[model samples]
Target: MCGSTVERFFRGISEFIFHTKLGVADVQLVDYVSDLMLRFVRVDSLYSLRQSDGMRTKHVVQMISEAERRIGLAKREVYRHVGDFTLFWSGMYPESLSAKKNRGESPDQLIDYCRQGKRAYAIAAEIEGGADRPSSELIHRMSEHFEMCAYGLREVRRHWEEDDDSNGLLTW
Candidate 1:
């Protein structure tokens, strides 16, 4: 699907699951999660952060390490990416964890995505401070309700899977 088509699809499903089904009325939270799904549709966006050698950082631990090595806005962005990465995987494609383990992917196999994701968001929120009040608040809400968001995404996955027309639209 094209960018606008994918965005519309995710936005519609996210609205249905989060607002109607889950009873979550936080519009910003719903929009953030939907935007996350839309962004992750592209393989490049899924692992957009690069390492020193120019490799896309694939592991949560590695991303965290990279985040720690930076400061200020860069650090905050990296931590935010870590949160987004963990949330996307654990919420949408949890079954892929075991596959990653079988492939000898490190750290993530032994760690909790929810924990890391929540902590990462918290750090991002703290780093945000008064410079961006709205963004910080949204990130704080994300940290406080990471599990709910993750559960909502899982519901989204289920909803799509059960739809007759879903077919290959969820290949990501």
Candidate 2:
């Protein structure tokens, strides 16, 4: 059942890429997201193994931990780029990037917001930690969120490509 679900998720992602106007930046983001998905699938599979054969559950746990580390790194990288671009596109200097316009707050004050996003990603990565009694609802929600991110990236790339084409800009 789990294997089939994973396969279906990958198929959906591929179909989305084929039907959407994916661009270089979007493709890059998709690659990162895809890597994360693959890692999750691996962790899930290992977890399933633990249920039928408890002998190697420890190994599965270790694998999940490693996958979590990788996911965390990827999340950090994504946020770093996203934050930089957010500041640039908004015409805000680095010092003012996190400032709250209405509240007159500094970027430091928004650290919790960033942490919340990263925590979501971290939780997704560790979704299989309790495989023996994993929450199916949570897994489904994570999968949906992953797909949404992929689709959003594709749309962003499509718009960027269109903008470049209209201006005769050589993105290559």
List model 1 lDDT by residue over 34-134, tens digit each.
Answer: 99998898989999999988998998988999999999888888988988898999899988977877777576778888899999999998886455433
State the local distance difference test value for candidate 1.
0.88
Residue 35 accuracy (lDDT) in model 2: 38
Clashing pairs in 1: none
Worst 10 residues of 1 by lDDT: 163-172
Candidate 1 residue spans exceeding 4 A from truth: 1-3, 102-104, 129-134, 165-172
Angstrom error at residue 35, model 1: 0.2
The Cα local distance difference test for each model comes to 0.88, 0.39
Off by over 4 Å in 2: 1-25, 44-115, 118-172
Query: Candidate 1: lDDT of 24?
Result: 99
RMSD of each: 3.2, 15.7
Error of 2 at 164 (Å): 37
